[model samples]
Target: MIRIHEVTRRFGDTTALDAVSLDIAEGEFFALLGPSGCGKTTLLRVLAGFETPDSGTVTLDGRDLLALAPHRRPVNLMFQSYALFPHMTVERNIAYGLAREGLPRAEIRERVTEVLDTVGLTALARRRPQQLSGGQRQRVALARAIVKRPRLLLLDEPLSALDKQVRAEMQLELKRLQHEAGITFLVVTHDQEEAMSLADRIAVLDAGRVQQVDTPVELYRRPRGRFVAGFVGANNIFAGRLLASGGLDVPGVGVLPAAAGDAASGDITGLVAVRPENIRFADPDGDADAPLQGTVLDISFFGGSSRIAVTVPGLDRPVLLTAPGPAPVAPGARVALSWHPESAVLIEETVETTVETTHG
Candidate 1:
């Protein structure tokens, strides 16, 4: 377990962490996710004792973690480069930590063997870093970090070096290893999908601040703010003012119904975010009339699903919708888009605030 309270770190004029606080449960697979310059890595470094916070408190299992030195802390950091010694064999690299601590040769060998088997690198134990593949070297690096059996493990973009297929495989592998090892994993990554797939809970950071912390399902389904809605997944955003009639009067587009409890009683202007998957194609001439109509501008096929971009009459940007299988209509075809009122999320617009929709 870990607790960070009002942690702030600054370098010159730049603030890396701005009074950030979080609680990580024991044996929890937690992820710190954000884009570059968002301070996810800085936060991880602070936790690892690599970087000290200007003011705050860090506690691990009720002990003062900030007071401990980097080596004395009950934690280990696995770098993105898989920093294994080139001259050392797999077993030697794994046992280096224990050896530095002056453990007996027999105990070091036993621990190294156990860790190699745990990471499924026993067969490659005799191979050097240069002699092994990237994945093998990564396992060696992991083995090295975990051989000490620290209470907490810090992984900085652990799977970023691998290709798509290998990254996917390692995602599951990391999850399995975490469970088997029963160590609390705190991973720092800019990849949203990776965090969602691997972490039990994720803390989304932006501009040195924590935007939202929640499970993958909760973050996707109930994003707290405009930035979170746009960042975590694909969402169609509409800027508008809330009307007293329980609907949002979006300029260009007509008023659309809002989810209950989203619209405030007084006059409030904000943005409405709707996931692409939540929108359905409807027939204009059918008995059930949809509120919005648009001309199909483009259709993109993505294996089992298709993305349709529609150009509405008054909307500035094309509305995007996702449907299963092939696209139902060609470009320039007229179509109606319908969505449930409950699916819409209201986001208040602020002068200094902007949403980053680019996926990590």
Candidate 2:
């Protein structure tokens, strides 16, 4: 297990990580996910002992990692580039760490052989870096890092270099390898699908802060606010206002009958976020609560699913809706869009702090 307590890091005047803290459970495939410059990698590097925090401590299994040197800590970082030694063969590259630790030749050979097999690189142990493909080199990098059997493994964009097919294969391989090794893994990735598919739980980071940390399902289904909803996936929004009570008053999507969350009675301005898949296309005349009756402006086909862009009156932006199957809707067709109030989420426009009068 690893715990980061109020960790902050700065380079020059810009803060890279700001009081970010989270606990990573042992054997959990934890992912620090965010877009570029969001400080996910900084947090990983802090955990790996490569980068120290300006404040607070990094602890692994209750031991203070801040006091330990990078090489001294029981952790290994697999770089994005697959940082394998080009001059050394796969076996030697993997054995390099063990050799530095002054292990006996027989023990090194045993570890090298064991890890190569673990990474499914046994047959290619004699090949050099240039002789192997990207995926093989990745396995070599993994084998080399895990040869020591460190208590924690840090993977920095481990599959970024691979093509789509190879990346998917490696994702499955990584998950299986984690179970086999039974060591904690902290992966930093910007790819949303990768984080959703690979992580046991994700810590969504943004601009030096953690926005939300939860399982992929929780993140998608129950996003807390504007950023989480928009960042996680495509969401259709209906700009409206809340009435004096807990009722919705949309100019176009009218009184979204069921109230959502804790939208205060007097707050007249708000937005509704509904996942594209949640919005179903229905016959306008058939349903009474026709929130959006629109002309289909654009339609895109993706074999399995299709996206229908609907243009509703009073809304400036087009609403994107996703439906399963090859036949969703055609462009320029009229459609009715409806959603259960409970299925949609009402969010404050942003995460900004509003001044509240907490009684003098």
Candidate 3:
């Protein structure tokens, strides 16, 4: 297990990490998710013992990591660039650590063969880093890191360099390898879908602080604040003040459950956020409860699905709706939209929390 207790880091006047604390369980694939300059990389470096925290401490399996050097720590890092030696062949690169440890040539050859086979690179053992494809180079990096049998593994944006197809394949391969090795894998990534699909748990960080850390489904369904809902995906945010009664009245979207805010009527000041998929197009003459009428403004094709932009009266921003196959309405067409009561979450509205909580 890896423990991060009140870790804080500062570079000059900027604080890269602001008193963050987390625990990464053994054999778990823990992901650090955030945008660029959100301190994900800084946290990874701290875990790898390359960067020391200004406050608090990092411990691995009861050993104080702050007291050890990078090489002395039982951790290995796989850099985003794959950082393979351009001149060395794949086999030699994987065996370099063992060679430095003064292992016999025969032992090094056996271990190298096994690791190459494990990463599906046995046939390309003689190839240099420059000679292999992007995905293959990444595999070589993985082979190098696991050959040492480290207690914890750190990956810093390891898939950003690959093409989409290769990235998808490598993501599954990495997940499988981590499970087979039964080691704690800590990955730093900014991609929400990646974190959702591959992580046992995700820590969403932003501006050197933790926004929300939980399972993907929980984060999506029950966002603690408005920033998380908008950041995770396309959201239709309806702005309106709370009524004296416990009911939410959006001029365009209509009255929702004021109880969602936990504040009584006049005390509520937040907006209601609903996901694009939750908003359904309805007939204008449907029901009085379906008062969300809008004009179709634009449509976009996304191969697997499509998105429609609708501009409604009393709202400044267009609402994005996800529709299957093709859009049902053309531009300039008037449409009615409705959503289930449970689909939208009403969180407190503060620009500070919005800016601080969103990961990407």
TM-score top scorer: 1
- TM-score for all models, in order of appearance: 0.93, 0.91, 0.91
What tens digits encode model 2's per-residue C-alpha lDDT throughout 179-290?
9989888899988889999989999898999899999999888876666777887876555665556556665446653364344545556655778787788788888667
* Whole-model alpha-carbon lDDT for candidate 3: 0.81
- Model 3 bad stretches (over 4 Å): 241-247, 251-253, 256-267, 349-360
User: Where in model 1 is the C-alpha error above 4 Å?
Assistant: 243-245, 261-268, 349-360
Each prediction's RMSD over C-alphas, in Å, is 2.6, 4.8, 3.1
Better-scoring candidate (lDDT), 1 or 2: 1
Model 1 poorest ten-residue lDDT run:
351-360
Question: What does candidate 2 score on TM?
Answer: 0.91
- Give me the overall lDDT of model 2: 0.81
Please provide, for model 1 over 196-279, each residue's C-alpha lDDT reduced to its tens digit, 9 standing for 90 to 100.
Answer: 999999999999999999999999888878778878888888766655556666666677667544345565667778889998
Clashes of 1: 0
lDDT of each: 0.85, 0.81, 0.81
| Candidate 3 per-residue C-alpha lDDT over 91-190 given as tens digits, one digit per residue, 9 for 90 to 100 | 9899998898899999888888888888899999998998999999999999999988899999998899998999999989999899877878999998
